[model samples]
Target: MTLSRDKAIIGAMEILSELIIIALLSIAGGVIAAMLPFAFPPAVISLFLLLLLLFLGIIKEDGLSSSSSFFLKYMAMFFVPSGVEIIEYADLLSSSWFHIILISAISMLITFFAAAKAVEITERLMQRRKAA
Candidate 1:
């Protein structure tokens, strides 16, 4: 009983620490974004900073694994607010429904084409490497 209790406590602490690290990085990203001359989303800046840290070996994947898993587990919850906002702005969305659908369709096609080309390039590169 004691052993299981201790393990639970340790696991909770680990998740807390991982969340703190992510929060600090996000705050730092916000500050950096504010200091920039051009308008840029702070969240994108945060993601880029996190990527840089990982690439530089300043942060290990294992360090964030728990928090990342937690986020993924509750990912649907994250979209709840967006859904609520859409409901709140249903009138505006209805008014622009046609434009929204057109833009969404165009963007989806562009994204699909880009992803297909990327995969083709990657496969060709891999095949060449195997041949070499």
Candidate 2:
């Protein structure tokens, strides 16, 4: 069964969860850095902490709402801004890098298959556990 429309969107406004927590952590780190007379960007500080949390397996995916996951799923598009730089220096990806492109394509295909298999295995395990 899927979540109802209202329930799915309820967490969207309650920033008390993931997004707000990351923002607060970043802000606190920024303040600490400023107080210590260190020279570090606030955004970078927050992102660093977020990565640390991720590494320690703190933030979870299951607790995230469908709407938040939707945004997170598409957020990779935000990298398009930096991706535009590839066109700014298009010559860097010319015919000389054809092998690189071919290898990258193959690697991406492999990664996709691997991730799909892993998810399938995980689902099977969960199903078996639930049945038991």
Candidate 3:
């Protein structure tokens, strides 16, 4: 009983630490965004900072592995608030549904085409490297 309790305590502590790290990084991004003159989203800055830290080896993937996995596993839940807000705008959506659907479909097709072209280019470069 004591051993299991200790293990549970340790696991909780690790989860807390992971949350703290993520919060701190987000706060750091907000601070940087505030210091800048122009308007910019703090979340975007935060993501960039996180990527920079990972690339510079300041933060290792393994350290955030568990928390990252947990977040990704339920990421759809994070969008629940936005989905709710869309419900609030049901009138606007209903009136412009056709336009919205058309734009969304066109944008999706463009995005898909761009992604496919990028993959093709990358594969061609990789093949050339292998040949040489």
Candidate 4:
């Protein structure tokens, strides 16, 4: 019983530490966004910062694996607030539903085309490398 309790405490501490690391990165990102001239989302800045850290070997995937997994496990919960907001604005959305749908469709198609071309270019480059 004592051994299991110790393991549980260690596990909880690890998760807490991982969460602190993510929170610190988010705070740093907010500071950077505030210093920038243009408007940008702090969350996006945080993600980019995290990506840079990972690429530069300053942070390891293992360090974030548990926290990331925990987030993914409850990802749907994150969307709940958005869903509530949409419901709150249902009348406005209903009025502009067609225009909203049209824009969404057009943007989705453009994104798909862009992604397809990128993949094609990447494949060609890979093939060329193999041939060389």
Q: Which candidate number maximizes TM-score?
A: 4
lDDT of each: 0.93, 0.75, 0.93, 0.94
| Global fold similarity of model 4 (TM-score) | 0.81
- Candidate 2 RMSD to the real structure: 10.3
Instruction: Report the lDDT tens digits of candidate 1 across residue range 1-132.
Output: 999999999989989889898999899989999999999999899999889999999999998999898898998999898888888888999899999999999999999999999999999999999999
On residues 84-121, what C-alpha lDDT tens digit does candidate 4 reach at each position?
Answer: 88988889999999999999999999999999999999
Q: List the residue pairs that clash in candidate 3.
A: none
Model 2, position 130: C-alpha lDDT score: 100
Worst 10 residues of 2 by lDDT: 59-68
lDDT of 4 at 92: 94
Model 1, backbone clash pairs (residues 3+ apart or across chains), number: 0
TM-scores for all candidates: the values are 0.78, 0.39, 0.80, 0.81
Residue-wise lDDT of candidate 3 within 1-132, one digit each (tens)?
999999999888888888888999899989999999998999899899889989999888887888999999999999999888998899999999999999999999999999999999999999999999
- Report the Cα lDDT for candidate 3: 0.93
Query: How do the residues 22-43 of candidate 2 rate in per-residue lDDT, one tens digit apiece?
Result: 5688688788678766687877
Instruction: Give the C-alpha lDDT of model 4.
Output: 0.94
Report the candidate with higher TM-score, 2 versus 3.
Answer: 3
What C-alpha lDDT, on a 0 to 100 scale, does residue 72 get in candidate 2? 83
* Ordering by lDDT: 4, 1, 3, 2
